[model samples]
Target: MTIIKNPVIPGMAPDPSIICVDERYYIATSTFHWTPGIQLFESKDLANWQLVGYALNNEEVNLRGTNTPAGIWAPHLSYDPQTKRFWLAYSHMVNMAGREFNADSYAIWATDIRGPWSEPIYFTSIGFDPALFHDEDGRHYLTILEWETREGYQAPGHIVLAEIDLPSGKLLSPWHRVTQGFTTRGCAEAPQIYKHQGAYFLLLASGGTGYAHGVEVGRAETIFGPYEAHPSGEPILTSSPRHLFSLGDPDAGHFEMVNPHSVMQKAGHGSLVHTHTDEWFMAHLMARPLEGQLLNPLGREASIQRMHWTEDNWLEMEDGSNLAKMTFKGLAGVPIDNEPNTDLFDSFQEPQYLLEFMTPYRQQHQSWVSTQKRQGFLRIYGGNSLFSQMNPAIMATRATSFTYEVETLLEFQPNHYSQTAGLGLYYDSNNWLYAHVTYSEEKRCPYLTLLQAKLGQRIEYVNTRVIVPEGNIQLKIGYDHGIANVYYRLEEQETWQILLQDLSVAYLSDEGVNGMPGEIGGFTGLFTFIGAVDAHQHQSYADFAYYKVTNHSPAS
Candidate 1:
């Protein structure tokens, strides 16, 4: 047997929904508040995964002014062998004010995974985390959380099921309220249905998406009926196995349930797959906190665990323990040789930016950002400031490791202070650190400065300004654990000068930032970006020669 390490897909890939078509396996993950949403990955050997493409490449959904952790949520991918088409269902979380959690769910289909997808068919605005289950008998069902806003109801809501027409996207039957949760850890959502041995299994993500997160199970003889909880009366998969009863808790951030013994936390929201070789494995979301801190700068990642069905038809971890492991056994005779593709170097030589690059709030288009404008450089026309959720001209990649360095050669000349372009460590519109070049009126020269936004408060490193000669400059950020060091060097200078050192960016994390009263601040992880801001007149633009990311840590 091969030893497969966890986190096959790292950094910001959460709420994984896995499906196996033929012998190939695909996993779809949520890309909240990020454009080109619903990231999909492909894997053949179950241990190695590759980014194929995104389901939402066009402006099928509007995310303008989207709040933190509120945009695309829990994208579920499914394949209908009968129709030979791929189906994707996701929710567009529009509002969280007053904890109403209003969202609209929709589904799209495509003959191919990467291609011209059909127009989205609106399903319902009742709740979020919508999933589609294509039954073996040609019937289809939609499972989603019926978000409860009543004062005296089950906290988040119940996992409801309804028959859905695939072509017309209409609900044929009224929703059936299934069990709230099979385990004591409540806050259940992300319901996925599977069939095995004449039974319909409902897999749920329970205890929220935090330290108390886990994957609970329930089975019913019919498609929608009274379901029986798992025999264990606990989550079959979780990072923390110790029991804690949180039935009525609506708060998703169960910080008190942190298990010190576990290296991986927030192991829930799983999607199971039965391979062609008759082996079973699950793709789920997990988080690795920074060393001893509860802060996860890398955010929720995708991890695979070995699983098996008992003689009684109940699913359990292959190791017989409910706790998720960092390393598990792979399929027999399958070799695990692929490593994580965390390191990236894009010189913008091609007509298009690398597919790994993603933007926030706005979709990537030739109007604002393109590589064809210049032969060897990516020219990005400045849009709005990072503070605005509407439009920000940023091209970023996920920070896959705690100890990594991002470097970019930027050629930008700013006439106004509002027209600045450089490298940054960004979490969202409200939390980020930028090292850019702008006009220095007093010195009468273009200089480099550091700006930070911590929980909506802007802080400028006024004393750490360095005057640089015009033209191309190399900007780099060396991130060690949770701290970041900014450096810059002129085109002619062989050595780099430090602009800011020992700046603790731990605040740019899910738990560090402030969000809605009872919810986690941010869901998307940290990203290193090459962006330009033109809040003045939107006439300024920046040219980036290359963007490079190097990971120092070993691939997980």
Candidate 2:
């Protein structure tokens, strides 16, 4: 049997919700503060996954100014075999200030997974991480995390259930409080219900979304009565197995739970699915930090592991251990030649673009970005500055590996300094490192320069400068762990000249930097983007001939 690797989908893909239809599998993941809403992937074999499409592509909701880790929360995907439709339930978090979490939940349906999905139907703003479960009795139920703000009570919240009308998006029954958590791994959320063998099972993400993160299970005979915790008082699966001394801590930077021995940390928030051969596997979120660093620049990613049921009907890993593994035995008779990887090479020659590319906050406006305008090149018309959430002319792909190189061929003409277009290592508008070709007042011509943004403050490095001739120039950025090196050369110049080297980019991560007091650095990971900024006038455009990303890790 082949050894399937962990993290079937990598780079900022978190809170995975998986579903299988006709032996084909699809996984939907959260896209917080990013455009095109929920990211969807398809896989025939559980090992190999591909970006197929997104569910919320239209203006069903406005994500402008959505804060870090706060736009689209956990998205739950479920299928109704009777109606032959797919239903998705998700939370649109508006604010998280002073730990007073305020969010709105909604659900949408689609006949096909690659949807013409229906406009969102309002659900409830009671809490976050809303999930939909269609029962065998033709009754639909919605389970969510009931947020509690009372003093001296259980910190984050409790799992609650209620019957709801799928058509009207109305609650048919009152809220029923379920178990706080199967164990003391508090910060319980992402509650989902499944039935098997005349018993209902509730699966939840506990221990927050940090190094102590894990998946817990509880079961009850009925839909919403008394539910009992699993016999074991610990999580069923996790990368960090050590006890969390700060169990009740609400800090997102729970650096105390970091496990140095494991390659993948922050493994939890899982969803389960069964294969055609009756084998069980779960897709969960996991993170890979820089070699010795606790900061995960890639954010929590999607991973899967094989499992089996105990004789008493409890679930455990196939190896009978709660600890997550990096590799598992592949399914029998399913020999998928492709492995899990997202090394991109976009030539911009096709009519459509790859789903791996994404923009921030707003829907991608065709007037600003298109490949049809120029046959072999992607033309990006500059609009607002990179800091603007509305319409920044930036097209980026996730940075999957710590040791990867991103390169692009750009042809841009800038008459003013406000109009700059080049490559950037972006983590929101507040934190980023850019090396671009813009007009230099001192040089009185086009020149290459390096700029940095820390907490929304832009700083230009004076030492790095190179005069360039008019035409196409190749720009490359190499990231070795936390250190990033920027290089550029004209088309005629064979040797690359270093613009900046050994610049520390570690701060642009989920831990190294932070947003508000209660918020973490940002759940959104680092992105390698070709961005254009036109603050003076929206008349500038940049043409990129090609964009390529390569992972340096041996496994990649």
Which candidate number would show the highest lDDT if scored against the true structure?
Answer: 1
Extract clashing residue pairs from model 1: none
**What are the root-mean-square deviations of the candidates from the true structure over C-alphas?**
1.3, 1.7
lDDT of 1: 0.89
The C-alpha TM-scores of every prediction are 0.98, 0.97
lDDT, each prediction: 0.89, 0.84
Model 2, residue 248: distance off in Å is 4.9
417-502 per-residue lDDT for model 2 (tens digits): 88888998888867888888888767677888888987778788988888866836899999988899999989788998888899
- Evaluated at residue 241, the lDDT of candidate 2 is 82
**Best-matching candidate per TM-score:** 1
Please report how far candidate 1 places residue 417 from its true position, in Å.
1.7
| lDDT at 322, model 1 | 94
